[model samples]
Target: MKNMDVMLLSTSCIQSQLMKELLSESLGPSITLVNQHTFAYHDWNKPALILVDLANLPTSNQPWELYLRGFKDNISTVLLNTQDSISAQKLLQWPNVYGYFSHYEDQETLIRGLTKVLKGEHWIPRSMLIEMLLYLQSIKPITTTSIELTSREIDVLNLLSNGKSNTEIANELFVSEHTIKSHLYKAFKKINVKNRVQAKRWARCHLPLYDG
Candidate 1:
């Protein structure tokens, strides 16, 4: 595992430096630590695990998403400083995101989680994982005939399946929240699904954008 790169992305210079030192001292020479800017000038040919400090992200730009998107599918990600499980779950919709470290976690816990993640295992909290499993269990497969969706409804459902909230979707589409709800209601009717999770499962099965 010598020279394995683990990049830490945090907008706060102080936080990035402190975390780099802490992680380097803790994990030893087997892991190479990179700051947010180091990877830009270098070609990362091997699969790397990215540690993103979500709490320090710029509220306006969301540059982290763009940075993560630049990586190949082999890139694994673990979100750090997550405030709550709901937001963490939503963020996990990204295919590369494997797990998260809560804001309240101590250094020992953080190190333990990172070690597990390095071993190609998820380090999510047990409670959060249970909640997620319950939600997934509730999403029953729905069989429907040929369904016709308006362009706007398709757009709404796509964002919804990507774990976007109604407000976020409305802002992205530049429409009112009420209008987004109307679109969702119509889409739900068309898809013959009742709620967001079911709709998301249906989209994963049927929608070309997210179809596996």
Candidate 2:
């Protein structure tokens, strides 16, 4: 019943205009649109949806990661790209990215993806989905014993798997710096790991890091 507020981030002017037109035509005029080259993660006014063209954006190691960490539970994200520009291997690892639609896809597919995303469903390409399943199947299962971890410890492991440092993880989770170190220490002990890198490897083997 309520209108959706959407933010569009793209380096291509044409792609931005096309998305605006398609969204307006499909979702009606009540939807609000904000076009920007870049956005700060701590902006007060959060949008309901964010559409980002990953290929067009400048090469940063973790731009999407930073954005996803900032708006993890609050906003839905759509990653737009050409099929050649993005690979299925990388796409499956983005937990917060709600969908991936090709720029060359038909208008109907794009509209359907947006609608599905708005309705709280993930929209992945069929081919990409198959590739993801295959990749999952190809990975050899770890035969290590199960370890008991507290919820907080799991959270710490998840952040560590994403290549976040203690300070960054602490800042993102709103915990004191000392508390983060404490959690990490306990997590390493529980998982029988010597360091953060080992913990990350263990997590990737056992946990569904990107299926949240």
Query: What is the TM-score of candidate 2?
Result: 0.59
Model 2 lDDT at residue 60? 36
- Global local distance difference test of model 1: 0.68
Q: Name the lDDT value of residue 32 in candidate 1.
A: 44
lDDT of 1 by residue, 115-161 (tens): 77777788876777787776555544333356877656766787788
Clashing pairs in 1: none
Q: Write the per-residue lDDT of candidate 2 for residues 70-101, one digit (tens) a residue.
A: 44455667877645667665664443677887
| Alpha-carbon RMSD to native, per candidate | 8.7, 5.4
Best by lDDT: 1
Instruction: Give candidate 1's error at residue 122 in angstroms.
Output: 2.0
The number of clashing residue pairs in each candidate reads: 0, 0
lDDT of 2: 0.66
Error of 2 at 136 (Å): 3.6
